[model samples]
Target: MLGLVGVDVDGTLVGTDNRVREDVWAAIERGRAAGMHFAICTGRPAVGNALEYARRLDPDGWHVFQNGASIVHARTGESLSAAFPEEALPGLLNMAHERGWLLELYTDTDMAVTQPGDVARRHADLLGIPYRPQPPEALEGTVVRVQWVVPREDEGTVTATPHPGLDLHPAGSPVMRDVMFISVTRAGVNKGSALGRIAQRYGFGMDRVMMVGDGENDVTALRAVGHPVAMGNADAPAREAARYQVGHVDQGGLIGAVDLALGL
Candidate 1:
């Protein structure tokens, strides 16, 4: 039987409205009732709506966030997160400032942005948080991830830039399709590696875990899972990595994935 289900946020859970569909929530409840574990796996930081969702999913279980830079227990506030490579921070900060880019730095729960404008405001809304932009130096806790929130047209340039000791994962939200979010973590931290850690903590192999997702960043976890389920709207990389396909997120595709997990 599948022991756990890891779900992506933007495309797999919520669509453009940025709210979890009622049917998806209902299905998750049913899965929980049947003793199935559910986890929110995403590029989002562990704060605001994301934190709330993690607690709601399974308060006692582990959830992966920040593209796997964070793995926290919803109820206990305990973390099995990878720390950001501090040595790489100065160069990234300098580069973003020089380029006038919208760069964000995040700890396990708090975040700060270099550019707080329309994009930052919209992101704050999506995160279900207030629009208070704090500087990176003022943020409390161990920093884990940094992201570049730029227009879709700038994705290529951002990814092409070289940053030693950092790994970049580019992703998009259905709600902000015109924008690209480039997440940077330590050299090897990602959803796949983090999922493995979560599985080990649970005393199970990754084959017993099912991952549902629909984006480029989801590709790593998708490829690592025994049952890789993709939403209908999944990007090419995600679809290619997944072994199963569900309906679109807007149409409550998560229900199908949950049902599959329960039966498997």
Candidate 2:
């Protein structure tokens, strides 16, 4: 049986409606009862709805947030987060300013945006937080990740830009499919790396880990685990990386994953 399970948030756990089904919750309870640990691995920062979900999933376990830059213990509030390469900031800041794109910066528990408007408001809603725009410099903790919130059409432009010493993981929420959230972290810091750390911390080999996800950012994690399950609605890259596939999130696909984890 798998010793650990890492799941993605938006496209894999919750659907476009942004809600977890009762059946999904019940499956998690069953998995926990069987002694399998679950972890939230996502590109989102650890705050607001995301933080709540982490605690709810495994109150005392560690979660991978900010595309793996922020690894926090939901119960103890201990962080094993990575630091943002400070040198990459000026170039990114300049890119955003030059293009007038909505850029966001994140610490372990807070986030700030450079441009705010309808996009920001919708993003805030998606994040299950109040719409509050603050300068990036105003965030109180160590900044670990940066993100570009742009229209789907602008995705290529953002990705094409040169960002040395950094890595970009582009993801889309079903809630706002036309908007791409491009998460930037220090080079080689991604969901796969973080999941590896989480497994090592628990003394589980990568072969003993299972990961379920449905987005571009999830590819790393899918490749990191022995049993990599992709959602029915998963992106092409995710599907290509996975060893197994489940139903859609809206259809309680996690229930199948939970059963698989428990060897049912």
Candidate 3:
């Protein structure tokens, strides 16, 4: 039986409305009853609505944020692992400036944008977090991840750009289709790497963990666990990486995926 389950937030647990369906919550309760723990794993920073969601589900479980750059305990607010390579900041900032894209720098606790834009405002509204407008020089302390918010159509152009020192991944929402997030992390720091660390910390082997996700950023995470369940609405790469495919989020795919993982 799986001891831990890692769920991606945007497209897996929550629907386009950014609300967890009743059935999803019920499934979570059932999983808890069966002695399984749930963790929120997403590219989002571990604050505001992101931490709130994880605390609501499993207050004591490990929560992964910044696409695995930060792992912390939901209840105690204790960090297990965090990565912020200061060396990669200059190149990432340069890339975003060259494209005239809005960049958000995330620390383990706070998020700040170089300048606010429509996409930044939309994200702030969705996450229920204030987007503090700060200069790049104010990005002090540990910077876990950097995000470039671009138009959906411009994703191709940004993807084509050469980012030699960073790992760029695409993230989008069903509700906000016009925008896409190009999340940047230090090379080799991804959801999969974070999940591995969490598993080790909890003494659960890869085979004893299950992962559910449905986006470009979720591909590596899906491939990290032994039971990788992809949502039907998942991106092509994510679906290909998973060992199983459940229904879409609208169809309570998380419930189905959990059932399969727990052998219900």
Top candidate on lDDT is 2
Residue by residue across 30-102, what tens digits does model 2's lDDT show? 9988898899999888888898998989999999999999999999999999999988888888888899999
Cα lDDT of model 1 by residue, 10-101, tens digit: 98988778899888899999998887788899999889999999998988999999999999999998999999998899999999999988
lDDT of 3 by residue, 46-93 (tens): 888889989977888888888888898998888865565777778777
**Model 3 stretches with alpha carbons more than 4 Å out:** none
C-alpha lDDT of residue 117 in model 1: 89
Collision pairs in model 3? none
Q: lDDT of each model, Cα atoms only?
A: 0.91, 0.91, 0.85
The number of the candidate with the highest TM-score is 2
RMSD of 3: 1.5
